[model samples]
Target: MSETADTLFSHVKPEQTGYVSGGLRDFFLYRDLGVAAATQGKVIAHLVKANMAPEKGTGWHRHEAEFQIVIMLKGWARFMYDDQETLVEAGDCVHQRPGIKHFLFDYSPDMEYLEIVSPADFKTIDVEPVCPIPDPTPWN
Candidate 1:
């Protein structure tokens, strides 16, 4: 491994990981994967869960980062990438370029995903809603 890689090694056990409030949605839980400290704030990784009411989501916003990616691990979510509605399900991945306005309108209760972004601490700028989003399906 390269010197940088060797210095940034990390091994995280699931059971030992803890979830905290997310950046955009307080209802979602986020699990840090020790990437921030490892990368010296160059990047960060988080496992996120949609544990809130179906009606509640991140709304319209954009990240102030150079790179951002999300890989769905379970369930699914509905988002508006600019003006296009996109459904991201399990085994799916999305690359959200910097400053790409999007709205997370709804999601399954069991939704889970891994999100990696450049710059450990990125800015989330809320924008005016640009589309009429559908209501989230009610969950049991």
Candidate 2:
């Protein structure tokens, strides 16, 4: 009897995968690969890794037809709304409703997080840039 290919299994190595950085330590995994959503019965969501500096963060933004779930993987950050603010740390999570005015502020040097969204093709919605990237060296 001969062994069939279906019985073969291999381990995946992390180093075999590649990562890309956007700006000043902000990196994104799967920035190049596009997963097929229709096959999975849902849209593909990408993982974003932000190792931001103090006072570094995303500008106020929203999505027209998608909801966002933000989970703090490490360090601390502040989530700001139009009239309120919430401080979140590792293991904390927040869900932003579609069309809400909000922003994230990284108050620590080692802040990291994950953002999961539905209909993953969604992009920023009429966002007005408020927080500009500060000088990288003085962030420490």
Candidate 3:
């Protein structure tokens, strides 16, 4: 965050936060943990949970940021980092190297994860697939 505001300590509680729509993915809900504001947009920390059954999933895309990571808190998710498929389960943490083309094609019903990315105002750009994307598992 080269051009960032002064950051302050933040203590956010569930009671003070609310999951809202209008995130990168419409299929998921995002709850800001107050980090972006506290950190003056240097970074953002939020909890994202499934809002609907997995269908198309997040298409192949990349973020224009210096750092990003996802920590699964419950359930599981199937992702393709380039040509390799990786299954992220509860307690798993994934560091998505900057500008890495990836796809989250499937996830459990109750899937929820904490995502932290540097520079709150990052950009998500759609990219051509690096490999064939797998169909999502049918929702029971």
Candidate 4:
């Protein structure tokens, strides 16, 4: 095997993960899975959780990565992918191609998901909302 390939391997247990305040937003938490280090910043794997409060979620934004995917692991979330509203629940998977406009409007208190993206650090460019959206339902 190539030395680069051999250097890019990671294994993480659920119990070994710890959540930290997501720098992008205060209403979310993130758990890194060592993918950045193993892949030499080529990829990042993380678990993201919605905090237990109703707040304007990640507004319309797009990633600067070449590839991105999200797999829901708990609860549900409502998102606006471009102009269409999408409901993502447990076991649902979403592949967000680079530059796809999306808005994460709201989510359940127990919402958690796995997100993998190319490049350990990706730029998120915020855009104006282009669709009518309902007021977020408060978390209990």
> Which predicted model would earn the best lDDT?
3
* lDDT scores in order: 0.87, 0.55, 0.94, 0.86
Whole-structure CA lDDT of model 4 = 0.86
What's the C-alpha lDDT at position 102 in model 2?
Answer: 66
Provide the lDDT at 34 for model 3: 96
Pick by lDDT: 2 or 4, better one:
4
Worst 10 residues of 1 by lDDT: 1-10
The model with the greatest TM-score is 3
* Model 2 C-alpha lDDT per residue in residues 1-140, reported as the tens digit of each score: 88554333333344643446752234223332233233242343344454435344566777754666877777666666654677878899888787887666545556556666666556675477544433333353
TM-score of each: 0.92, 0.62, 0.95, 0.91
Cα lDDT tens digits, model 3, 1-140, are: 46434878799999999999999999999999999999889899999999999888899999999999999999999999999999999999999999999999999999999999999999999999999988888889
RMSD of each: 1.8, 7.4, 2.9, 1.7
How good is model 2 by TM-score? 0.62
| Full candidate order by TM-score, most accurate first | 3, 1, 4, 2
lDDT of 1 by residue, 39-106 (tens): 88999999999767767567789889999999999999999999999999999999998999998888
Alpha carbon deviation, residue 26, candidate 3 (Å): 0.5
Q: How high is the lDDT of residue 68 in model 3?
A: 97
Task: Flag clash pairs in model 1.
Answer: none
Model 3 — which ten-residue stretch has the worst lDDT? 1-10
Task: Quote the positional error of residue 27 for candidate 1 in Å.
Answer: 1.1
Compose the digit string of candidate 4's lDDT tens values, residues 1-140.
44656356679887888899955678889998999889888888898998657577778888899999999999988988999999999999999979999988888989999999998789999888778776777865
- Candidate 2 residues lying further than 4 Å off, grouped into runs, are 1-16, 22-41, 51-56, 127-138
